[model samples]
Target: MPTSVKIFDTTLRDGTQGEGISLSVEDKIKIARKLDELGVHYIEGGWPGSNSKDIEFFERTRTMTFKNAKITAFGSTRRKDSKACDDINLNRLVDSGVQVATIFGKSWDFHVTTAIQTTLEENLNMIYDSVQFLKSKGLEVIYDAEHFFDGYKNNAEYALQTISKAQDAGADWIVLCDTNGGSLPGEIAQIVGAVKAHVSTPVGIHAHNDCELAVANSLAAVQAGAGQVQGTINGYGERCGNANLSSVIPNLQLKLGYSVLSDEQLKSLTSVSRYISEIANMHMPINQPFVGNAAFAHKGGIHVSAILKDASTYEHIKPELVGNKQRVLVSELAGQSNVLVKAQELNLDFDRDPQKSKEIIEKIKEMEHQGYQFEGADATLELILREAFEGLEEIFTLESFKMLVEKTANHAVVSEAIVKVKVHGETIYTAAEGNGPVNALDNALRKALIQYYPDIKNIHLSDYKVRVLDEKDATAGKVRVLMETTDFSSTWNTLGVSSNIIEASWYALVDSLRYALLGRTRIEREDKDQLEQLGVVNH
Candidate 1:
């Protein structure tokens, strides 16, 4: 069996320290459950005594059962003059009802002398008393030597003494923290190796990313006999953020041969990263390592050609292994292989018709030169390809549309739109009012087609983004509209470009509806085919 390195996720406690990150109690619980599902060994819940929301989180999560991760409450050691048993922070950790307690104390002499204004001996006493008190309470104690790296560099003997005190007090794990996040990977390895030699207790590492070396330093610590790794999902934390567990886990499991999470649990890494980002209402970094959107995306002609032959030619690892897929992005740099790969991914048959593939490649290059980006709008690209090769017919034809906006003297504005559509050669006209012209237009168009295709009601636009093609041209510049729609089954993006923003938005909206209707039609046809196969119906 391979060595198992424990994964300690501090997203709830340390991650919220990042700017603009505020997690409600409910959000904390949701994230805890998700982290549990992702197979983290330990989850550091926030300081119970620091705030009411964190207190509430501990209270609510007391009843919630986690499968693999043990909930750990985080806090500092006993205060300057307080005994461990009488410390309010230590009492809150006990009341939090977590099985593990992780407490930090000043390891650096500078912090002990200046920040805490306490004697070096008293800080050592604090570490010993706190860990022993927690251990006496039937709670596992993990002592965090705050600023351990900086402290070790300044006074190695005193820094080693702090960890030694915790180890003597029966600390289960003594974690060396690069709290300042200034140490490089080589320095981390040397310090961790020295600590391993000095302390008998199991060692762990907590790294920050001020130098973009958090992940590197973490892996280095592991190589130097640190049994536990502490980080956050997506590297969320204060300053530059902590080491990203999404990157660390894979590096340990796949690259270093250390088992952190099971292969099956590791597959959820990308989804878990995205889920946290969604809950935080933050944009997922498309270029983040391992779990990012562009992790396995190929665009260059030579790269795409080689990747199509064998994915490993350009990719470091199979994307599906990390819950991601290889994306052959269509752009001006795309070649015939890029078109073929993208077409195949969309379930379009272009293998037998090489001419159609060339046409798509040419068309994409031309559109890209005209400032029409298709990389982010796969649904639009699929529609164009289907129309060219599969002979996809228009589900509905737009006859005409008119939008009206009226503002009265009282300052109340009313927006209404009327849409005319031809479905199966029958003309339908519908009008609707909304808070804005775009909403009104969307309502009117959907109302016109609802009777003919009731499934259109299930499809609703989730996101709409508009960008100016050329800012120098100002009002004369063309606008690109991207619409993301979902029908409970899947989400897809459609795009349109025009000088008029309304026209561009209308075009994207229409394509979104048509794409959804096309999916419904295909499913219905498949259902009919299955029935015919069972001899229940005849064509």
Candidate 2:
């Protein structure tokens, strides 16, 4: 039988410490529920006493039930020379009323001396007292010895003593933490091996990604007999980041055959990763391992040709296993097979026509020459296909648009824009003022279109990004704008490119709204198809 490895996820705690990641109480609860569903052995929520939001999380989460996961409350150990039971902060950890307690203690001499202003001996006493006290209260104690790797490197005896003290105090799991995130894989393995030999309790490892070696170090520790892997989902943390359990969990189970998540839970990995990213309002990293946009995305004729023959030639694991599907990107470098796969993915019935495939491939190549990158603009490509197959209904058209901006004496740059659009055999004109020319133009167009399509009231631009096509300075310089919008149901992103900023912005903005409505239309169409199949459409 393979060893059973416990996966401890800290996305709600450590991951929230990542730059620009601040979750509300509601956000934390949602993420915690997802993590529980993901089959993580332990969910390390934030320090409850430190913030009201976290306090609310514990208060609310305690009432819920998790069939497989335990909610662990995280905090630092007792203060120096303070009895754990007497320490107010430690009492707060107990009062949080969780089944598990994960407390961090000083392990490195430098942190003990400088950060905590305590002596080395006092730090050991703090670890011992905290774990013993928690155990006395019948809580499962997980002692995370902060900076353990560096502490072991500098003062081996001191680090070993800290681990020993936690074990002696009846800690259920003695977790070695690389708080500084500077240790290499070899050192991690060696220190973890030494710690395992020195202690009888289950040993665990927590690593950060300062040197971009958190994942490697975590695997090394597991090989060295550590039973638990501590990391945040998506590798989110302060400074660089912590180990990513998304990669760690799958690698451990698939490569080493160490049991972590169940096969069913593992299949939800991609959805879980994206769900958290969406709630946190962060763009998911396109190259994130196992479950990213580019994880299974293939391009280039040679690679696509081989992938078509057998995915295992380039893929390490089946894409479906991680809740992700293989994607064939259409670019200038792509071949006929790439387009065919893409068309298939879109469920377009091209009838396996070689001539039609060649034509689409040529059209993509021509679009690429015009600074229209299809890889980043799949919605646009879908629109192009819809127009080609079913034809498009142009209910509205932009006749002309212009803007003027000037600096006033008391005010900053003043801007006004006028838009003339023809809709439903009528020409409507609108003028709007804004902080900038782009804003003015957007407001004017949106104001005019709301009357024609009342659903446009649900449409609002959520995000906008502009990128320069080339570094050259001249009339040849082209710009691309990506726009994201949300309707009542879902969000969609589209892109446009032009030498004129207004033109590019308008193209992206118009498509963004249309894409949202189009998605709803498709969902309705699918529902109708199901109804027809069941003979319920007439009803």
Candidate 3:
């Protein structure tokens, strides 16, 4: 039987320490609920002793129900000079109303002498006193031996004594911290093994990623006897970040056969990861293992060919296991397999026309030479295929558009656009104001077209990014614009490239509208197809 490794998530606590990450108490509450749905063993609410916000967090969630996770309060040990019974930090933990308390103290002699200006003996007493005080309050205590790896390397005997003291103080769990994040995996495994020998308390590992090895070190610790893994989703924390439980959880359950989240909850990993990143207003790295936009994106023709026959040839695990799907990208580097797969993914029936595939490949190569990249712009590529296969009639034609920007002393800058378009062979003229040139154009064009296509009102641009294709040309360089549009249900990426920035934006913007116009889908593509099969065209 595999060991059930307890997952302690600190996204609300340590994760908020990451640069630019600021979560309102409401954001923390929402994240806590989602974490419960994901079935983690514990959720650290934050240090109630530090601020009013953390206290408010506990107060807000006091009556909330969680099925799988305990709300744990985080704080440091008693002050060096204060008795545990008289310490404010200790008393705050007891008053926090949470059943669990995690407290950290100096495990490294260097930190005691140089960082905290305390004697080594006093540091030991701090760890022991804090754990005992919390235990006396009938709270389950987890002692974090901060910098245990570096401390172990400096003075192995003293490092052993910290956890030994914590165990003697009746701490429920002894978690070793690689706080500096500089220790290699071997050092982590060896030190954790030594701690296992020194204590009867269950062991856990909390690793940081300064060296990009937090996940590796965490796995090493578990192999060497740790039963709990502490981390945040997408590795959010101070400095580089903490170990990413998004990667750690899958690695533990799938590779090491450790029982963590259930199979059903495991499948929600990708959605949960995206949910947190969205709420944080941060972007998850596209290549993050197991649960990123490009984790399974195959672009190489040969790679696509191999994956078509056997996904395991190119993929380590089934992407659906983590709620992500394989995406076939077409570019100048693409081959026939990429074209076929991409066409199928977009539900475009090219009828397996060999000549058509060859033509499309050449066209994409030519477009790439012009700085147009279809790989990251699926909606634009879909529009291209629609033109190729069906001789798709233009839904609307742009007659002309003009933009104006004006500024005066002691006044805000203003932007406006005038647009003329022919929809259903009827000329419509409209003008609108917006925050920027592109926004004005979008608003003006949308104003002209929404009367004909009401669903256009539902689609809105979510993101826009521009890149210089030739920096040597400087101000005259061609730029590529990528735009994302979403209907709050799904999103599509469209792009265009031109020497004129506004021209590039217009191309992407038009493709965005065209894609939405063709399908008008706000639900899954399969559902849209089912509705179409049932003769529900107006929807």
Candidate 4:
């Protein structure tokens, strides 16, 4: 029988600590419920008394039941010289009605002497009394020895003594934290092994990603006998970040045979990861482990061919295991199998046209050489592939456009934009005013396009970003514009770059609209085909 590991997720707590990630009470509750459904062993809600949102979460979460997971309230230990029962923070934790309590105490001498302005012994007392107090109140207490790894390296004996204090005081679990995230995997395993031998309580590991080794260190600690792993869902935390439970859970259970979530539900990992990213309004890390966009994507010809024959040749785990679909990308370096797989994904039926496939792939690679990364934006890439094979309609074209900006008497900037377009021998000229020149131009373009494509009304610009390619001289650098757009159902991103900001924006705007229209068309066709197959429609 495989040993079971507890997956303690702290996304709502630690993830929100990420700068600019301030989730409301409703958001936290929503995420907590989803995590419980996903079978996390524990969900670390935020410190109730520290913030209003967290306080609201505690109050609201009391009424909800997480079927599989224990809801944990996270906070620091009671202040030095304060009785645990009387400490307002401790009372808040109890009143919160959380079944579990995680209290952090300074383990590093530097933090004790400098940050907290307290003696090392007083910190130990704080950790011990807090754990004992919470445990006595019938809550499972987890002692977080903040900066434990660094403290252990600095003063090995003191760090051990602090953990011993928590264990002796009734902490159910002792979490060793790499707060600075500077420890390597080998060092982590060795230290965790040592800590396990010394501490009586079950050891858990909490790591940060400063060195980009939080996940690796957490796993190493588990291999070294830690039964619990604490992390954020998408590795969200302050500074570099905490360990990513999404990666940790899969690696521990699938790669190491330690039971975490249900084996069947492991396939939902990708969708879950993307869902959290969407909720947080953060860009999903394409290269994230196990469930990332590129986790199972094949690009090179040799790799694609081998993957088609035997996936295990290069892949460590099956793509479907993490709910991630395998992507055989078509580029100049792609083989026949790459083209076939790409075509199949797009529902394009082809009968072994190696020459045609090669030509299309070569064209894609040539375009990619001109600063287009199709793999990064699959929707745009899919459009390009379809256009190469089926030829896209021009429908409408940009003829000439001019924008004028004027500062009003009230110092508010007014933008006026005019556009002229010829659509199938019909000339349409439109003028619009907007808050800014870009908005004006955007309005003008939309005004012109909606005449033929009324569905364009459903398209909305979600986000726009501009980056300078070269910063050697601020005045002379190429600029890149990235635009994110949403239609009825899905979202897509497009990129364009030029020396001129307007030109770059225009390219990205047009491509973003094209991607949306193309996706809508594909979805409609797919629905029609499904209806036909179900005998609801006939050709």
RMSD of each: 1.8, 3.1, 2.5, 3.6
Model 3, span 428-487: residue lDDT tens: 999999999999999999999888788888999999999999999999999999999999
Q: Could you tally the backbone clashes for each prediction?
A: 0, 0, 0, 0
Q: What local distance difference test score does each model get? A: 0.91, 0.86, 0.92, 0.84
RMSD of 3: 2.5
* Number of the top-ranking candidate, with lDDT as the measure: 3
Question: What TM-score does structure 3 among the candidates reach?
Answer: 0.95
Candidate 3, residue 340: Cα displacement in angstroms equals 0.5
Ranking by TM-score: 1, 3, 2, 4
Query: What would the TM-scores of all predictions be?
Result: 0.96, 0.90, 0.95, 0.87
Residue-level lDDT of model 1, residues 123-239, one tens digit each, is: 999999999999999999999999999999999999999999999999999999999999999999999999988988999999999999999999999999999999999999999
Overall local distance difference test of candidate 1: 0.91
Write one digit per residue (lDDT tens) for candidate 2, span 1-539: 12989999998899988999999999988888999999999998889789899899999988999877899999888888778889987888889989999999988888899999988888888888888898999899999988999989999998899889999999999899998899999999989889888898999999999999999999999999999999988899989999999899889989998988889999999999999998999888898989998999888977988998999988999999889988878889989878767777778766745777678778888978878877777777777766665566665788998888989799799888899999888999999998787789888988887787677778877778888888685656799888877764666678888998788988987777566656656777789999999889555
- Which 10 consecutive residues of model 4 have the lowest summed lDDT? 368-377
Assess candidate 2 and give its lDDT.
0.86
Q: Give candidate 4's whole-model lDDT.
A: 0.84
Flag clash pairs in model 3: none
User: What are the per-residue Cα lDDT tens digits for candidate 4 across 76-134?
Assistant: 89898888888998888888999999989888888889998989889888988888889
Q: Residue 388 in model 1: shift from native, Å? A: 0.9
